[model samples]
Target: MNLSTQQKLEQALQRLAPIHLQVIDDSHLHAGHAGNTGGGHFSVFIVSDAFAGLSLIKRHRLVYDAAAELLPSAIHALSIQAKTPDELK
Candidate 1:
């Protein structure tokens, strides 16, 4: 994976004002799958105020909006587990 992804992730977190953010590249797990040739798929654990009062769907949408440009290109799959810090505990 390139630093650009991390930078992009950070930017997204900044936009969301996340209390906690974890980004794990799962591309190796999908090495043979389509869109896996590029460095993209990831599992994200995010705790952010942007998700605090939102429904699960909304939370996902927010994250999706943050990385909208990466979809189907720089990022193919994102296994997102969005939560608030309190919700996580």
Candidate 2:
């Protein structure tokens, strides 16, 4: 089977060094949603020490950095729940 949305998200996080992560593709729920024309919406649950000492906004910036061009184009909406491993534990 092809990699699921969660798997794809996991891969993204892993590529960025993740301590914890959960990616959920909620595309099915947004059939006619904007940007959902091709790809879909995603909820990213990520926790990593890489986020330590950074503000939430900065953490999101990092995610966007990692996602780069994929954001909004391939991923319509990304509900990012990012945290540091210390916060997760």
Candidate 3:
């Protein structure tokens, strides 16, 4: 069986070896939007040491790269919150 978008996100982002990761699927909330189609809407909260010294833009870029195959395809939207363990305190 094919994996869901949420599952794919989790698997892809695992490359960063997050200390904590949460993925929320919000596709149902965009039922009628043109971009909705079969693609999914999601938000991710991830804490990882990999993000330790990166700037906000770079951090987002890292995440984007991680999910590169899903963008504008299986995933219509993604809201990400990337942080380090210390930042979570």
Candidate 4:
């Protein structure tokens, strides 16, 4: 079975136990752009306790690590907004 990029991202990010998660596909917005052969562009908004006390870079690192296998292939680029639940309140 084949999984869509959004599905793949959701599955991979599950380890974070996010209180809220949203994956937006922005491929259409970049259509015809150079370097966009087949891979998709995405934006992720995730709220999880896992981000507590972590710096922005560290939070982004966690997100990148989870989605490492998809980089430059299934996913060409990613924009992430990772925040702790407390930070949202």
Candidate 5:
């Protein structure tokens, strides 16, 4: 029925077929902040072949496009580290 923000994010990112993926909820770190209303802050660490040949901005764009529906509501801020598997070697 209802999924947590992390779950939702993970589900959304699955489209990338990541070799490794981690979603960290950083909402608590910004607790009581002025701009924080109900949305959560998150960090994403992902490794996927999809990132190969893509620039940093393009990689982030892909991530953002996947999670577009959650922005400014289910997700307030997102920090992403996207890398290709080869880059990890």
Candidate 6:
């Protein structure tokens, strides 16, 4: 069975043990865009110890890897904000 996009993303990123995580589906805001072909647009904000000392690009890659299965299929565009808990201060 296929999980919803948000559920899939949450399950995937659980590996990060995020202290804070928010996933917002923004598909309605992009209606009619070429990439909107049924896939959703999402924005993610995450804070996790696993992100400590990682560069922004590395953090993003980690997030992307977690949700790799959703890309170009259930997800069209993703806006991400990944940070270590300490960085949230």
TM-score to native of every candidate shown: 0.83, 0.80, 0.91, 0.94, 0.95, 0.90
- lDDT score of residue 57 within candidate 6: 97
Put down candidate 2 lDDT per residue, 26-71, tens digits, no spaces.
8888888653547778888887888889998999988978876566
lDDT of 6 by residue, 5-83 (tens): 8888888889999999999888889989774668899999999999888899999999998888888788888899998
True-vs-predicted CA distance for residue 19, candidate 3, Å: 0.3
What order do candidates take by lDDT, descending? 5, 4, 3, 6, 1, 2
Q: lDDT of each model, Cα atoms only?
A: 0.80, 0.77, 0.91, 0.93, 0.95, 0.89
* Selected candidate, larger TM-score, 5 vs 6: 5
- List where candidate 1 sits over 4 angstroms from the true fold: 34-39
Alpha-carbon shift of residue 80 in model 6 (angstroms): 0.3
Q: How many pairs of residues collide in model 2?
A: 0
Most accurate candidate by lDDT: 5
Worst 10 residues of 1 by lDDT: 32-41
| Higher-TM-score candidate of 1 and 5 | 5
lDDT of 3 by residue, 1-89 (tens): 89987998899999999999999998888877874657789989999999999999999999999999998788888898999999978
lDDT digits (tens) for residues 1-89 of candidate 1:
55677578657667888888889877778887753647577898898867777899999999889988777677878888999888977
Error of 2 at 31 (Å): 1.1
Which regions in candidate 2 have their CA more than 4 angstroms from the true location?
1-6, 34-37
By lDDT, is 5 or 6 better? 5
Instruction: Give me the overall lDDT of model 3.
Output: 0.91
